[model samples]
Target: MTEILGLYNYWIVIFLMMTGFYIVIARENLIKTIIGLNIFQTSVFLLYITMGKVTHGTAPILKASHGGESHGVEHGVEHGAEHGHELHAAAEGHVDLGVDAVKEVYSNPIPSVLMLTAIVVGIATTALALALVVRIREEYGTIEEDEILEMDRNS
Candidate 1:
């Protein structure tokens, strides 16, 4: 299952996205509409998160705690403590660092960064919409679009 998931995760995410889009477009109730929108947005996030996942690739950020670079320097280690700098050399149990593993298997970082910005935009839109809903409810005593329409027609 893991193999299949790793292979076709993009298709699954696309399917979810289409389903959520259909729900958002077909729904009528205002609150239900908002829920559908949330689902659609979440599906997009899932797609990005799925793409960001790498089977063996390391994280984008360099951390001191993970013994990546700074940790090696602080441990009073010799020149070859961390597998040395030879391009063809491999660590005790790991693959050689000469090969560009990140470039080969990992998705691009630009997409991940763009998706994070999109998520922030989605959250901000949702919050602003909710605030508008609250204001509309206070003014009309109802949050339903149809009810608001009826009130407008009667007035």
Candidate 2:
């Protein structure tokens, strides 16, 4: 359906989330579990990025087709005179100087910024997990969960 196709990114996020969860729950290898965690993290990132997007949206940058100091000053003076208020340039003079004609939607940037931070934290967590796994392997001489459990039981 059109609705289903329109939300394809959500579908991908769901698939990746499930696949990662399956790997984490079903696999015994620590490295594979780390990979699964990474996959799960990526799914979260994709979800956030997708949620932050807007249809036909542009960046949050302001594009001034008719904006300048003179325009702002003139508009401000006119607005003040019409409203019978003494609006100074610093108060409300430059409120709608150049962006009144711009009706473009802008995507939210907070989600993307938070996801970027999450990505860095995820990488650091993965590295620490892998390092711990390496130490475990060195101490146990095996990376298999069952074998390690058996070794522990015997010891």
Candidate 3:
């Protein structure tokens, strides 16, 4: 029961993904297609947000605390590197905080930040696509895929 509960979000994500995929593939109207694209984008955003979440973690904000220290060495670090010391190697793009070193478990913020940027871009792209659709509708008198193709072939 607990395991299933934990995975409810995943199930929701899958449902959204499938719904969006179906819309994009099965629709004929240009506006509908754009809506489908938006749905698909929404699912992607949700997926990224979900993946970034930590089971018992908080936000990835650094807080000042004078609490007790931790102990343990992390893997994938240099041989001479000390335990509980994370590397700030941007080239490698990975850091290992030793076991229990970070008292407050913070969820990875990278995905959330990236998703924010993507959301902005997606909004702009969606707006542009809708504008193009409006123009297409005005010129062709219809937004259906078949009608647009007929118009093109007629021209």
Best by TM-score: 2
TM-score of 1: 0.61
Q: Give the candidate order by descending TM-score.
A: 2, 3, 1
Off by over 4 Å in 3: 1-6, 63-101
By lDDT, rank the candidates, best first.
Answer: 2, 3, 1
lDDT of each: 0.68, 0.81, 0.77
Q: Which residue ranges in model 2 land beyond 4 Å of their true spot?
A: 61-94, 97-102
Which candidate do you rate higher for lDDT, 1 or 3?
Answer: 3
lDDT of 1 by residue, 1-87 (tens): 998866687888788888878877885766677777877888898887777776676566533343453443334234345555632
Which regions of candidate 1 are displaced past 4 Å? 1-7, 61-107
Per-residue lDDT of 71-100 in model 3, one digit per residue for the tens?
122233452254434454421333333233
Q: Against the true structure, whose lDDT is highest?
A: 2
The residue-by-residue lDDT of candidate 2 on 1-155, one tens digit each, is 99888888899889988898888888788788889999988988988988999889876565565346546667667877776747554345355543453465778888889998999999999999999999999999988888999999999
Q: How many pairs collide in each candidate, listed in order?
A: 0, 0, 0
| Model 1 score (lDDT) | 0.68
Residue pairs with backbone atoms closer than 3 Å in model 3 (clashes) = none
TM-score of 2: 0.74
